[model samples]
Target: MTGHDRAPGSRIDTSKPHPARMYDWWLGGKDNYPVDEEMGRKLLAIEPRIPIMARANRAFMQRATRWLAQHGITQFLDIGSGIPTEPNLHQIAQRTAPEARVVYCDNDPIVLAHAEALLRSTPEGRTAYLQADVRDPADILERARDTLDFTRPVALSLIALLHFITDEDGAYDLVDAFLQGLPTGSYLMLSHGTGQFTPKGAAEADELYKNSGITLALRDRHEVERFFHGLELVDPGVAVIDTWHPELGEPVEGQQDFQPMPGFGAVARKV
Candidate 1:
């Protein structure tokens, strides 16, 4: 079962490509428009290994979610939960802890349209969706409370998010605000795009997104680690998404071909 969909009236915009839809395109999903494909193709032209990156990122999330579940984290609040894919966070979490509860939030109306896929919780668990942006952390945290108990430990998953948010937009402050709401022992799981290894290619991709009216801020390792400040980072600290905990999940088909996936992933606990 799932909670009610709380979306302030907003129409699905197809004129411009959305990050989530473009991401869907990268993942070979059918929930994207031509505009999104056009943009996705352009990005792929810059880096042919993008599809591998997409799958590797999902694999990282799966491994991280399973690790958290095995470690006794039963509640998940996944903000920026994009278009639903198979074996979502709830599935991985509830597989270990049947009574686990998950709340999915995303700003995209397209995701809201397909929210049902995210709501099919197991008989022993619960799921909910919220059509909201991460910028409005307060509103998301408040509504999420309806499905998740804030007093307990909740793993906040920000997978493949945050790069869209610029420092001018208070990205650090936003992360801090969400962390403040969670009690001690809560965890933050995040994956961020970086321009470190492929600086030239990363710059070109950033320009492409900028031209398409999207803000893609690929941070360096130091900048990405800033979000985990004051938290106890898990072993190996921040790492290339695929390398974080490879033993927890199976390998992606083309991940080895691409070397590093140009992203960093880490899980940190609030002490």
Candidate 2:
């Protein structure tokens, strides 16, 4: 693994909220700051199911990682990986396939600060973390090559990450670049926030994020599927986050009681 690129004693911006920190708060983690808590609480006020959605999103990550492991996919490139929670991507993959290799990348300095928890790997496997952004697909792909074999099938997960990237930022093109860099049989796994179910509420959430200096690129189901262009979507093609193969893993508590989270998730093969 390469050395930590970020300098020690980095100043974490506690004045403004950040996605990773807010997500950490939503997941009931302590790595978040008060600013994050304030924003998360506001979001909850807007949508009471925010925490459930976070857990549901996390459940998707776990199930998808397990599926990839069982399907003989031993390499993972998970970008936009938020603050580490227990049984993270490596934990799930390594449990099913001890030899699975995982490389996690995120632009957040806080993620880098807590990256030690993410680096612990089983003796038979490997894990690495990169301090980078999703917009720079080439850098991520090039660095991931150090731990992952691009020649083989890899599950590239962008879970709950794309909403932060907008069209003007070349979101689709970045995905295409990453997919293009991988060999055939590689998979693209993603979960994206959408405005489909509740456009007004979603717009309000977007406004809040915008005012807080965050970007929420909420897309509809069709637009989210566009990121998988040319790939063969797996069974149960892009549906609400909770609908993608609920049978594969334990259903999130109260997930069925609430309106489907305004997000879609799917896994597809490059073919």
- State each model's CA lDDT, in order: 0.92, 0.88
lDDT of 2 at 247: 78
Best by lDDT: 1
Per-residue lDDT for 150-228 in model 1, tens only?
8899999999999999999999999999999999999999999998999999999999999999999899999999999
Which ten residues in a row are the worst by lDDT in model 1?
1-10
- The numbered model that scores best in TM-score is 1
Task: Report clashes for each candidate as comma-separated counts.
Answer: 0, 0
TM-score of 1: 0.98
Task: RMSD for all candidates, in order, please.
Answer: 0.9, 1.5
Q: Give me the runs in candidate 1 sitting further than 4 Å from their true place.
A: none
Give TM per candidate.
0.98, 0.96
